[model samples]
Target: RDLNALGGLAKLMPFTAIFTLIAALSIAGTPPFNGFMSKWMIYQSTFLSGNGLLVFFGVMALFISAATLASFIKFYTTAFGGEPTKLTQNVKEVSSSMLIAKGFLASLCLLLGLIPALILPLLLSPGKALANVDLSGLITT
Candidate 1:
């Protein structure tokens, strides 16, 4: 849908707005979301590498992350906040199936963030085997 059409639709479609908000927050790397976990690991690894250039890039990454956060905040607020426009006057919540799918993915984002250890083995196994490195020790500490 066009950007103008989304104005005020959040009230008509609250659930979808909520889902979008969660996804946006996750993408922005807010804490307790999957994106934050991966970004945190990246920053940690970059800093630990002790390379001057990599450290500079890591700082750049932090600035980029902040920019992303601001952009998403503006997007969510503009699309979902304020009074309903003519185009959004009749908007309604989406079907249950769509909501179920979105809810499932959003919950996964939370689960992955809160307990990454559960999925680390599945994620690291192939890399571990290919590189002949012991990632178990790395993941635990």
Candidate 2:
């Protein structure tokens, strides 16, 4: 899609705009979001692996995160930040069913971010059991 063709839908489609913003921020790995939690775990694992290649991967991940943040900023501004273009001016908010689904997912993202400990064990358990390792202690340290 042409970025130039989309602009300023926040007023026209407030719900859609907001959900899109949340999705963008989550994808960008900003703090207090699930994306950041996942990336944090990844960085920690890579750094703690004691392997040169893994450490390098952590650095690359940092760079990629930054790039993702910048790109999303531009996208959100163009699509929902500024004044709506002709193509977007008449667009309506998504259906209630879709909104409910997006809202549920957004809430889960916030819940996972706000209380990551609640989900962390469930995530780490299978890995620990399969590898027969004390990954929890490694993560805490």
In candidate 2, what are the lDDT values of residues 1-141, reduced to their tens digit?
A: 798688888988888877888888889998788888988999998998999999999999999999999999999898787787789878888899999999888887877877788888888999989998767766651
Best by lDDT: 2
Which structure among the candidates has the greatest TM-score? Answer: 2
The window of 10 residues in a row where model 2 has the poorest summed lDDT is: 132-141
Return the TM-score for each candidate structure. Answer: 0.90, 0.91
Candidate 2 lDDT (Cα, 0 to 1)? 0.86
Per-residue CA lDDT of candidate 1, range 1-141, in tens?
A: 577566876888888888888889889998898888778877876776789999888888888999999999989988999999887788889999999999998888888888888777887789788999866665532
Residue 10 in model 2: lDDT: 90
- How many clashes would you count in candidate 2? 2
lDDT over C-alpha atoms for residue 40 of model 1: 81
